[model samples]
Structure formats: structure tokens, C-alpha cells
Target chain A: MNYLLDAFAWIADPAHQAGPNGIWARLGEHLGYSVVGVLLACLVAVPAGLWVGHTGRGRGLAVGLASAARALPTLGLVTLLGLLLGIGLVGPMIAFVALALPSILAGTYAGVEAADRVAVDGARAAGMTEWQVLTRVELPLGMPLLIGGIRSAFLQVVATATLAAYVGAGGLGRFLFLGLRTQDYPQMLAASLLVVGLALVADIAFGLLQRFATPAGLRTTR
Target chain B: MRWIGDNLDVIGGHLVSHLLLAVPPIVASFLLALPVGWLAGRVRWLRAPLLSAAGLLYAIPSLPLFVVLPLVIGTGVRDATNIIVALTLYGLALMVPATADALRSVDPRVVDAADALGYGGVRRFLTVELPVAGPTLLAGLRVVAVSTISLVTVGAVLGVPSLGMLFTDGFQRNIMPSILAGIVLTIALALVVDALLVALGRLVLPWTRPAAAAVVAPTQAEVAP
Candidate 1:
């Protein structure tokens, strides 16, 4: 009880705040980098997932890569990548992409795989090319799932980005690591609270996105 | 040939570290979640709060949680309390969902039948509810097990000598063989553990397979017998 209370006190103390501006400013910089990383991961994984799922041709290979990527721990992957890329944001960037890929691929695959096959077949029968069938029928049907994958990837990047602090990439993890080193309970608790809060917010945002992105007819079954 | 022959002991040590790092948390999470999940089902008011707390705990970043834990307690790789606490939080999130799902998966008709027969409270639960829910519970346990094994790597980020340590050491040294070995071993461990969970689930909850399938097979056929 005392430990939890003391940690909260430390965070609340004006004197304990880092930098001249406050924690929020520090947060803004970290969020910038982390969001950029997540965006890059989305750009890669979502497209790759769409291709794999929409085509149904590379699913096994995609699943294998995704599972392998997920199995690779962030610390090891980031640190190793850091060794190759020489630290900074690039290492964590790659690691988060690897972390987010499986979920994205799974979501994308499950989404398109679940699409009504008859509609797609009908489109093809009605003089639509395979490409036209995909764009006009399959892709729209798969939008909610594709968006869901993006949402999961976004949350993953947000939470895991804290590890970037280990390599001096700077994020909420900085506060967490610093607090541990200094035995500053408040800072550690504060950082943890912020990260958890951010995750909850993201989850809520994703819930809203799901409602909006999904066609109303589809939402009922889901 | 010389390199492979000479460093056999170190490689063996790495393998041991990897196994040790992976197993404990899984064993612990399953044992711990069963009772908590059971308690949650028994106590209606406790379910929501406990689940929410578990979710919050689950969202914590692994590295940060490990680093912070040592400050609350003392530091050491063998600091079982810290490792257990850190992992308990992680496993708790999965377990709550798993347990709730397991319980929810139980056929309400089974529960009603038990009640209709005058098998009340603990008697009904021991013989009917829990037995019926067993497969669902084991399914949850499987998820918890897989998750625990993977996240145990978090312990390595704190410099605990485990499989994750091997990965970290190799990464620091830029040794591909060692790094690859760690990754491969961890995946192998996860696969083996998951397979074992499946086998255990099948053995313990034999009825679940048919029951689960039956639930979705045209409710009209199930007309209140």
C-alpha cells in the first residue's frame, strides 16, 4: 500500500518532473517517434497482409513469417537490429514492425478469408476481372478486418515502444528505466500509469474505429 | 569444426538458460489462474473489477515492469518473488479472460439440470458445472501457457540468466549462431508446451470437444429435452 502511494506521490510532485516544460512535452516527443514507427509498420504489414489474404496464395508463408516474427522477443530483436543499424529509432522501428506484423496479418487474413465468397464469385461471373472483383467486392468486405489489424498494430507499437528507452531512443521507458536506476518510485509509477492510460485510450479509439469503419450490416454478426 | 567442438559447455549452458527462462512462469500462471478464475465465477461482484485490473496489468510493457519490480523488491536473477509477481500480473490478464470464457462456454442447460435435480451449490459445481467447464478452462490455460512462455523472455531484459539472456548476449556480441539458437529454441519450447497443453486439455476434458461442436449445430434440434 505504501509503495503504491509513495509512487503516486513522487509523480505528483512538481519538483520530480523532468525537463523545464513537464512530462507532457517529453511525452509529445516520444509519441511522435513511436507513432511514426507504428505508421511505418502499418504501411508494410497491412499491404503485405492484404496481398496474402486477398490472394489466399502465400498465407502459409505469411503465417510462418508472422509467427517467427512474433516469437522473436522485442529486446533481442531491437538490440540485434541496433547492432546492425547502429542504435537510435531504426532498431525499435524494425522490431515493432516485426511485433505488429503477425496481428495485422492474422486480422487481415481472417477478415478477407471471412468475406462472402459468393459475392466475389458473382462479381467474377458478371464480367469483372479478378482485379476488379478484388477492389470492388473483396477489399470493401475486408475493410473492417484490415482496419482491425491496423488498430492492434497501433496499440502494440505504443506499448512496446517503451523498450526503445533501453537503447536511448527515448520514450516513456526513459522515465521507467530512470526511476528504476534511481529508486524513484513516483516516476516509475507515473510512467506505467501513462502507458496503461495510453493503451486504454487506444483501445477505446479502436472500438470507435471498428464501429465506424465496419459497415452496419457486418457489425451485427460481429 | 574446432569452434563447434571447443565451446560445447557454453552452448549447453545457453540451452539450460533458455529452458529455465521459459518453463517456470507457465507452470505458475496455470496453477495461479485456476483458483482466481474459479473464485471470480463463484463471486459475481469480483469478476468485472478483477478482469479490468488484469487487463491493465497485461498492458504494462514487459521491460519496464521488470526494471521497476527490482526497485520494489531487491535485484537478482533468482529473485523469484519479483519474477513471479511480474509474471503473475502478465498471466492474470490472460487467465481472467480465459477463465471467464471457459465458464461462459458452459451450457446453461447443464447448470439448470443440476439445479433441477436438487444438486445445490458446491455439489452441483464439483460434479457438473466445473466438469462441463473443464475444456473451456483448459482452452484458457493453453492461451495463458503460450503467452507466459513467450513473455518470460521479459525476465531476460532485466539481466536474468535465461534463454533471453542468451539472445541478449549474442546480440551484444553480434553472434548470429547464438542469436539464431536462442530464437529457434524459444520457438521450439513454445510449440512443445502448446502441444502438451492440447494433449492435457483433451485428456482432462474429453466431453468438451463434442459439446462445443454441438452448441452451434442447429438449436432447433436441441429442443428442450
Candidate 2:
């Protein structure tokens, strides 16, 4: 189809591959924002999740909050915050962090909760302190789930990072919104293809991480 | 508040239009996924491939799908049908897996018990597996409902009218109230619809215990913008 060919040709264009507005830069910006946002989310959510999971309290609140959080619209949050936070990266990053937080938090506590109770008991019974039990028994046992949540967060942040262009931030969304406004279907298709490629790569990489990261005995389920 | 008061009609219209774009996909995908999900659950060889396909579909970020679907379907880029169809695909992504899981969770012995009592495959599925799977299926439907309603807002980026119109319109005009109203209304719509779903679930499948329904199943990553 000409549509598909034009999109392929558009990406193949040497001229389109460079400049501040180029595909490579947009991809970099997108990855940069996603990585930073996800890291920020993990830092905040992981500790809190561990606390709740290890202590077994506040689960009711966490579940309610995460579900409510899931209902909030990503674009609505981005636009609202982007305007209020004075455009650029400030607003979108904040919103992205917020959006990514719930899943990571849910994943963390859920993973920790899913830890083998017998192993935890054994760790405690064998003269390990509470902190030692948490670190030695639960954390590694729960790595797959925590990583699952982290990847979910990573994917979410990447999606929001794409929408960053709407707020004067730079990313692959630049191509997307630009093409949308200009009716450049090939350019739009090109951006879509590039994003799909990134998603597949990330998915496979994380799939590998989630698999090998799991302690072999624990890898049977989940 | 005065802005809301002044634009009540417009807000109401957008709300109506938003429901139009959001509801059918939930219904269509729920109905469409049942057979696909049932088959995927029933067949040994199909589950992995079917679910992986769903994962691939869900992995495609929503905006890209919105743009690409028109190309595949020959709809205009801005067509409402594009939003409807996109939302349905997303619903199927979440529903198919949930549906399969739900069906798989049904106790095989209970199904056998039903079979011993003169229930045929169709009758047994209706009498046993579907009822057992009801709560999880409903949980999945609720997830679909919430995410689909929220995702519809993204369509406004391409100039469709919905509550998201308020966000875009508000942002362009630097009107905080409009954006806030949009966000609140969209969330409100989700909650209200979710409540309706809970009621509907109870009405249609009264056998599912409230205790089991208390645990809201974790929704799989819908992979949205």
C-alpha cells in the first residue's frame, strides 16, 4: 500500500533522521522522560509498598487508592497539570510520576504479599531479625512481581512521555501531534511504527528480566 | 462554578455524547470476547497464542491505534466510529484474558457434577461455568468500563466531542474550571457506571457470593496513553 510505503520511505529519509525535531532526538527524549519518571515512581512507591507488604497493614487503603487512581484519565491529568505547572517538562513529569505510582505501588505490595510464608517463617525462626526476613526472604522471592509492576510503570510513563509534546515538551509525540495537525499520515504512521518497535523491545527485554530475575524455584507461577 | 452554570447545556451535551462513544464498546467487546475467551479457555493449544495476541494488541499505545485503525478500516481519521472501534479493541484486550481466566477458574468437578445431572455442554456452561465465572467476568467488565470511559477522552486530541473536549477547550482558553470539570465528570461517569455494573452483576448473577466479589481482581495492564 502507498500509505505503508510512504511511511516507510518517510522514516528512511536521511533528512528526517536528524535535527532538533528529528526522530532520533524525539526517541531519546521519550526514553529519557520515561526512565526518569519510572525511577521516580519506583523510588516513592517501592518503599511504601515494602512497608505495607512487610508489615501487612494499610492494604485496604492501597487497594482503594490504586483502583481510584486507575480511573483518572491520563490526558486530562497531563493537560490540567501542564497548564498549572507552567508547561515544559515540569507538569508532564509530575503527572507521569503520579500516573505511574499506583501500579508500581500495587505491584510492590502484592509481590511482597505473595512471598512464601513458610520461607519467611523459616527465616524468622532461624535467628533472622525482622528486617533480615524482609530483605532475605520476601524481597528476592517477590522480585518477579515487583519487576512486573515496575515494567507496568515503565510502559505507562512511556505512553505519557509521548503525550509530552502537547505541553511544549519534546518527544516522539512531536511527530505524532505535528503530523496530526498537518494531516501527514505517513509521518504519523512512521511515528507509530517507531513507538511499536520501542514497546516490543522493552516488552521482550523486561520479559527476560522478569523471568531470569525470579529465583528459579519461584518462577513456576506468576 | 459560574462557568459550569453558564455552560451547563454544553457540558450536558458533551456528557451525553461521551456516553454514546463509551457504552457500546463495553457491550460489544463483552459480548464478542465471550466466545473467543471461552474457546481460548477450552482449547489447550490456543491459550498462549490467543493471550499473546491480546498482549500485542494492548501493547500498541492507544493513540497509535487511533491513527492506524482508520487506515485499516477506511474510516476518516476523525470519525466517531474510529473511537468506538478503538475502545472495543481495548476492551477485548482486557476482557479476553479475564474471561479466559474466569472460565478456567471454574471447578472442573463442579462442571462434572452438572454433567452428571443431565446438563449438556451448552446447558452446563450456562448453568455452571458462566455462573462460577460471573464475578471475575464482572470485575473485568468493570475494568473495561473504567478504562474505556477514560480512554475516550484521548479521542478529543483528534477533534471528537466528549467530556475530554472540556479539557482541551479549557486548556486552550487557560480556563482551570473547564479542565477540572472535565476530569471530575469523567471520573464521576466511571464511578457511576461502575456502580451500575455492580448492581447489574448482582441482579443477573445472584448466586455469586458478596465475599468473593469483595476482592476486585487486579486488572491486567491495558497499556493506554
Most lDDT-accurate candidate = 2
The positional error of residue A220 in candidate 1, measured at the CA in angstroms, is: 5.0
Evaluated on chain B only, candidate 2 has a TM-score of 0.91
Q: At residue B123, what lDDT does model 1 achieve?
A: 93
The residue pairs that clash in candidate 1, if any, are B18-B163
Off by over 4 Å in 1: A1-26, A116-144, A179-189, A219-222, B1-24, B31-54, B67-78, B108-136, B171-178, B202-225
**Local error of candidate 2 at A204, Å?**
2.0
Predicted candidate 1 versus true structure: per-residue lDDT over A1-222, tens digit per residue: 465677678667777565734566557756776577667766777777767777888989877776665555666666666667776877777777777777777787777777799887888889999778767777778878877777767777776677667656677777876876776666766777677667767766775786787766677886
Which DockQ values do the candidates obtain, in the order shown? 0.27, 0.59
lDDT of each: 0.70, 0.88
Give candidate 2's error at residue A40 in angstroms.
0.9
User: Model 1 over residues B121-200: C-alpha lDDT tens digits?
Assistant: 88987788777778766766666666566667656655566666656677667666665656666677777877888877
Tens-digit lDDT string for candidate 2 (A1-222): 678899899999989999888888889988898889989988899999999999989999989878988789888999999789877888998988998899899989998999989998999889999999888889998888999888878877777777667777888888988898999988988887787777767777887898898997865754
